[model samples]
Each structure stands twice: as C-alpha cells, then as structure tokens.
Target: MRARNLAVVLATIHRSGPHTRASLAERTGLTKTTVSSLVADLLEAGAVTESGAVRAGERGRPGVAVSLSGHRVAALGLEINIDYLAACVVDLTRTVRLRRIIPADNRNSDPAAILESLRALAKETTAEAAAAGLRVIGAALAVPGLVEGGMLRSAPHLGWRDVRVSDLVDMPFEVDNEANLAALGELWFGPRESDFLYVSGEIGIGAGLVVQGGVFKGTYGLAGELGHVVVVPDGPGCRCGGRGCLEVYAGQDALLGDLGSVRELVSRLESGDQAALEACRRAGHALGVALTSAVHLLDPGTIVLGGIFAPLFPWLAAPVSGGLGTRLAQMRGAPPDLVVSATGSDAAVLGAAGLVIQQIIAEPAKLLGL
Candidate 1:
C-alpha cells in the first residue's frame, strides 16, 4: 500500500509537472499528511526534487514546488538495425543523456559476433550513464524482427531465426520489435496519443499499433507486419516470399538502390529529379494502400510516419494523403491525421529506454531495489 501511494505521488508529479504537497494530495485523493510522507520519501530517494516556492494567493504562504528529478534514475535503450547499432540513456524527465550509433551491416553476420559488439556498446553506455549520476535500472533491445518470449522469432533482413536475445546480453533486459518500440516511444515521449498506427520505414517497412497507450501485439507478437501486407498481388517479389509487399516499393533498398546512395537520392530529389520524385510518389501510394487497410481494420485516431519516412515526409505526405483521402473519404468526417515522428530515426532507441521507465513507473519499489 505504501509503495502504491509512492508511485501515485511520483506519477502525479511526473504527469502534472511541479506540484505542491497540497495539490498532490488533491490530485491523488490522499491526505495531505500521506502526500507529505510520500514526497519526503521520494526526495530522499532522489527521484524528485523541490523547486522554489509557488505563491498560492495573497493570503496563503508560498508552497514548495516538487518535480521529478532528472539526474537520478535512468534506462538504457538499445537498437540493432540491419545497418546500425544504437544506444541511448534517458532519465525520468525523458531527457536523453547519452546516445551513440554505429553503422554496421548485421545482415548475414554471425549472431555471436553481433552480440559481442552490442555487449561492448552496452557496457560503455552504462558506464557513461553511471558517471552522469544516473542509475540504469533496466535495458531493452529493439530488433528489426519478430520477438516472442525474449527470443527473436525471425528477422528476414538480418537472416536471423529463432535466436535467443537473452543468451546474447548478460544483463537483465527486454526484447521487442523495433517498430513496436518506436510506437511506444512516440506514445510515451512524443504526442502522447492514445491510439495511432506508427509506420517505420527503414530497410524494411513495418508498423506498430498503439491502442490506449499500449502496443497491440497480436497473439504471436507479430501483429503489425505492415511490410508484408500485399499491396500489389502480382507485383515484384519481396524478401519475405510475398508478391508486391509494401516493402518492395517503399523500403530503403527499393527506393534508394537505383539512385546509388541516400545522399545522392536526396540531392536529386532536391534538384527536382523526375525519377526521384516518381519513386517517392510510388512509395507513398503503396504506403497509402497499406495504411488504408490498417485504417479500415483498426480505425485508429492517427497515423505516424516514423524512421526514414520522417525525413521523406515532405515528398511522401501529399501522395499518401491523396490515396487515403480518395479511399476513406466516403466513411468519415476526415481522414486520420498523418504526422511525421518527432523523434525521427531515434524513436526505436528511445522507446527501448521507455520500456525500462515503464516498469519503474508501474512499481516504484523497483527504484528502491536499484
């Protein structure tokens, strides 16, 4: 009961910003005495701090403002993309303290070697976080594949199947799909929307469904396989053994391969290259078709284009919107709001950190344990 009250007070302050003891009591429905006790405990634990006093009115004395401390508890976020390995440390205030990304092609590479590299990176990140006076309570890995029971079921891009991530990382950690984590990151740290479809456009296309602030993983933890959705029944073959999958048209390789490199492609697009514009248009249309299916089935409130899609949103938005507007115009007042991710490509990594922060929020005693 005491631990629960402590969490309530902390979460209240976290959500509402600086709050006085009396205000916290009113918000939490706890007595002022209990709120004071909990706030004291949090202050001692370094989980929260007291700011300067806030004047209530002309009659009453100023009350001390209490807010979450940014220097203490932290979580380590890790990501393993086909082209890069990234790590970030985020505090309770959602401030990123340290981040590092290394370019590496993990596709067809030995899993053991990849794990060793990640371990080294994790060790370095943890040390740096500790030096910053932050305790990393937990770690999470965002993989570009299907994760079930802490094991990667399959990553067509990485060519990894049935690999146990726990065996690879010695520390206590949680594993999840990169797209799912990116959705959670956006939910927890970005717009704070309750329902949305987060599409990740990387080397492959994937999506994560956020329903009421929770990721809706299907029964097999493969709920949002947007990349595999068949947009063209008899189109080009996909790496996933499917014809005309969304990834075939919109994925990084498909869109950028013919142009030589991402830099060259972006330069050409800026220069009004007809081919580049045409490619983006086609990719946007494919994305719209897949997203239309998503909307019809789930009817989410918003659609977030994340990962590499964010950078290309300027060129992709019009086509995507045109397709969705034409298809869904019959049913609703307006098509769902399509927005680029605020975190850009960093969403997955930050979302991995959010996994740790979520556990601590759910059980404040975990902070005591740390």
Candidate 2:
C-alpha cells in the first residue's frame, strides 16, 4: 500500500505538474501526513524537488511545489535495424543526454557481430551519460522484428531466427518491437495523443498501435505487422513469402527503387520527377489500403507517419486519403487525420530509453528502494 501510494503521489504530480503537499493529498485522496512523508522520501531519492513556496489562495499557509527532478537518473535506449544500430540515453525528464547512430548494413550479417558492435556503442554512450551526471537505471533494446518474453522470435530483414539477445549483451535489458517502441515514443514525446497508429516506414514497414495512452501489443505480440498485410492479390512477392504485401509497395526500398536514397528521392520529387511521383502515389495507395483495414478494425484517432514516410507525407497524404475515402467515410463519418512524426526516425530509440524512464516515474518507490 505504501509503495502504491508513493507511486500515486508521484504520478499525480507528473501528470498535473508540480503540487504542494496539501494539494497532492487532496488530489490523491491520501492524508496530508502521508503526502508529506512520501514527498520527503521522493526528495531524498532525488526523484522530485521542491521549489519556492507559494500560497494556495488567500487563506492558508504557503506550500512548496514539488515537481520531477531532472538529475541523477537516466536510461539507455538501443536499436538494431536492417541498416543501422543506435544507442541513446534519456534522463528522467525525457531529455536526450546522448545519442549515436552507426550506419551499417545488417542484412544477412552475423548477429553476434552486430550485437558486439551495439554493445560497444552502448558502452560509449553510457560513459558519456556518466559524465553528464546521469546514472542510467536500466536499458531497453528495440529491434525490427517480433519480440516476446525478452526474446527476438524472428527478424527476417536481419536474416535471423531464435536469436537470444541476452547471450550477446551482458546488461539486463528489456526487448521490444521497434514500431511498438516508436509508437510509445510518439505518445510520450510527440503530440501526446491518447490514441494513434504509428506506421514505421523503413526497409520493412511496421506499425505500433497506441490506444488510451498505452501500446496494444496484442496476443502473441505480433499485431503490428503492417508490412505483410496483403494489399494486392498478387502484386509482387515479398520477403515475408507473401504476395502483394504492403511492404512490397510502401517500404523504403520499394519507394526508393533506383533513386538509391531518401535524399535522392526527395531531390527527384522536388524536380517533379514522374517516376518518383508515381512511386509515392502507388505506395500511398497501398498504405491507405492496408490502413483501411486497420481503421475498420481499430479506428485509431490519428495515423502518424513515421520514419521514411514523414518526409514523403506531402505527396503521399492525398493518395492515401483517396484510398481511405469511401470506406472510412461510410464506416466512421471521416478518416482519421494523418500527421508526421515529430521525432522522425529517432522515435524508436528515444522510446526504448523512455521505457525505463517511465518505469522510474511510475514507480519511484522502487528506485527509492522503499
């Protein structure tokens, strides 16, 4: 009960901004004495700090405002994708203390080697965090595949199966799907939406479903495989052994084709290149088709275009809207608004770090060892 009360007090303050002991008690339905005691514990643990006193209206004694502290605690976020490895640290305030992205082609690469490099990168990032006076409480890793029970079940893009991440990295880390983490990232750091579907466009497309401010991982942790959703009956073969999958049309490689890079694609589109325009239109149409099913089933309030799609949203939005037009309007009266990710490609890694930070915020008593 004590631990739960402590968490309640902390969460209230975090959600409603700084609060005095009396206000925290009133808001939390705890006694003023208990609020004071918990506030003292939080102060001692460095999870929160009290600011200058302010009067609570015109009739009572002044009280100090208690808010989340920005020092001492932090977390590490790591990512292993088809073309890059990344490490980042976020403090209790969700501020990025350090970040490093190493560009590498991990397709068909040795998992052991890739993890070794990631470990090294994490080591370097943590060292830098230490210099910033932040103690990393825990770490989480994001991967472009299905993750269940802290094990990566499969990452077809990386050409691995049954790969155990713990064997490669010594740190005790939570493992999760990159798109799921990206969605959490968007929820925590982006527009702070209560419900949205974050579509991650990369070498392989994926999505993270956020509902009521929480990620819905679904049964078996395999819900957001938007890439393999068959958009065409027999459009083109996909690496997932499926025909006409959304990834075949909307993934980064599919959208880029001979353009080689996103930068080049952007350049070509700026010059009104017909091929680039056509490719985006096709990809957008496919995305809309896949998302139509998602909307009919899930009805997300917003669809956040993330990763490679953020940059291409201007050209893609109209086509996607067209594909979603008839069915969505008939079903829900209007389609959800499409928005670009504020964090861009950094969403997943930032979210990986955020997982640990949110834990600390939600249960500061654990960090206090109470």
Candidate 3:
C-alpha cells in the first residue's frame, strides 16, 4: 500500500509539475502525513526536490512545492542503422546531456563486429556521462529491424538473422525496432501528438504506429513494416525479397543514388536540377501511395516524416500531400496532416534513451533500491 502511494505521489508531481504535500494529498486522496512521508522518501532517493512555497488553498499557509528532479540519474539510448551508429544520454529532466554519431556502412557486415563496435560506443558514452556527474540507470537499443524478446529476428539490410543482443551487451538493455523508438521519441520530445504514423526514411525505410501516445505493435510485434509495402506491383526487387516496395522508391538510398550525401541532393534540388527534383517527386509519390493504405487502415490523426525525410520535407511534403489529397478526396474528411519530425534524424536514439527515463518515472522506488 505504501509503495503504491509513493508512486501516486511521485507520478502526480511528475505529471502536474510541482506540488505541495498538502496538494499532493488532495490530488492523491492521501493524508497530509502520508504525503509528507512519501515526499521525504522521494527526496531522499534524489527522485524529487522541494522548491519555493505555494499556497495549498485560499485559506491555508504556503507549503513547499515538490518537483521531479534527479539530475544525476540518466538513461542511455543507442541506435544501429545501415550507415551509422548513435548513442545519447538523457537525464531525468529529459535533457540530452551527451550524444555521438559515427558514420559506418554496416550493410552485409558481420553481426558480431557490429555489436562489438556498438559496445565500444556505449562504453565511451557511459564514461562521458559519468564524467558529467550523471549515473546511467539503464539502456535501450534501437535497431532497424524486427526486434523481439531482446533478439533481433531479422535485419535483411544487414544480412543478419536470429541475433540475440543480450549475448553481446553486458548491461540492463531493452531492444526494440528503430522506427518504433523514433515514434516514441517524437511522442515524448517532438510534436507530442496522441496518435500518428511515423515514417522513417533511411537507407532501409520503416514505420511506427503511435496510438494514444504508445507504440501499437501488432500481434507478432511485426507491424509497421511500411518499407515493404508494395507501392509498385512490378517495379523493382527489394532486399527483403519483395517487389516494388516503397523502399525501392522512397528510401534514402533511392533518393540519393550516386549523390554521396543528402546535402548533395539538397544542393542539386536547390539548383533546380531536374533529376533531383524528379527523384524527390517519385519518392514522395511512392511514400504517399504507401501511407494511403496505412491511413485507411489505422486512421491516425497525423503522419510524421522522420529520419532522412525530415530534411527533405520541404520538397517532399507537397507531392505526398498531393498524392493523398488526390486519393482520399472522396472520403468524409481531409487526409491526415503531414509534418516533419522535430528531432529529425535523432528521433530513434533519443527515443531509445527515453525508454529508460520512462521506466524510472514509472517506478521511482527502483532508484531508491526498494
């Protein structure tokens, strides 16, 4: 009973900002004494801190306001993509204290080598976090593939299958799909919409369905494989053994081609290069075609373009909106609003760290070792 009440008090403060013990008691239906005791526990655990006084009510004396703190408690987020590896540390206040991204072509590489590199990156990040006086509570890894039970089921782009991540990393880590983590990142740190479909356009495209501010993994935790959605019935072959998939047209590789980088594509598009413009148009149209099925099936209130798509949104949004408008015109309402991700390419890694932050918030006592 005390444990549940402690969570109640801490959660109330976390959700509603600072609160006095009297106010917390009123909000949580607990006695003032109980609220004070719980707040003491939270303060002792470094999970919260008291600030200037606030009036409990119109007739009562001012009481000290308790707010969520724990500046020293942090979470680590890691990501492994086809072309890069990323790591970040987020403190309890949701501030990103440290970040690093290393460019690497990981396609068709040995999973052991990749994991070893990631382990080294993680160690470096944690060391930096410690130097900054932050204690990392836990970690979460985001990979561009199907992840389940801490095992990577398949990553066709990386030529990996059945890789147990736990065997490689020696830490408290949670594994999840990168797109899904990106959606969660957007939810906690971006537009913060309650419901949306997040499309991550990278070398290998993926999508995450955010329903009610939570990821909606399908029955097999394999939902939102938007990259493999057939946009062209007989277009081109995909690494996933699919034909005419959205990735073939809308993925970063498809858009960049031999350009070497997105900046090159952007420069060309700015110069009114007909080829670059045509490529973006094709990718946008393909994305629209893929999202159409997604919208009709899920009916999300918004759609977010993330990863490489974020930088290209200014050029891509119009074509995607046009395609959706043309297709869903007969419906009762307009198509979902499309927006660029706030964190852009950093969404997945940020979300990976956020998972640990959320766990800490959900159970503040864990930090107290209770």
- Give the per-residue Cα lDDT of candidate 3 at 104: 96
Candidate 1 error regions (>4 Å): 55-59, 167-171
Q: What are the per-residue Cα lDDT tens digits for candidate 1 across 1-370? A: 9988888888888778698888888789999999988888888877888999996445578899999888888889999998889999999888899999999989887888898899899999999999889888789999998888999999878989988887545555899999999999998889755788999999888898988778999998889889889999999998878899999999999889666566687788899999999999999999999999999999988899998888889999999999999999998858899999988889999999998887777777665552
lDDT of 2 by residue, 1-370 (tens): 9899999998888888688888898899999999999999888877788899977557799988988887877889999988789999888777787889999999988988998899899888888988988777778999998887777889988987878885445554798999999999888878765788999999888899998778888888988999989999978888878799999999998899977679889999999999999999999999999999999888888899999998898899999988888668877788998888998889999999989888877777776576
Alpha-carbon local distance difference test for all models: 0.88, 0.87, 0.88
Ten contiguous residues minimizing lDDT sum, candidate 2: 164-173
- Evaluate residue 13 in candidate 3 and report its C-alpha lDDT on the 0 to 100 scale: 87
Ranking by lDDT: 3, 1, 2
lDDT of 2 at 287: 96
What's the lDDT for candidate 3? Answer: 0.88
Candidate with the larger TM-score of 1 and 3: 3
Higher-TM-score candidate of 1 and 2:
2
> Whose lDDT is higher: candidate 2's or candidate 3's?
3
lDDT of 1 at 139: 90
Per residue, candidate 3 scores C-alpha lDDT tens digits across 148-259 of 7999999888888999886545656899999999999998888665788898898878889887658989999889989889999999999778799999999888999899
> Which of 1 and 2 is ahead in lDDT?
1
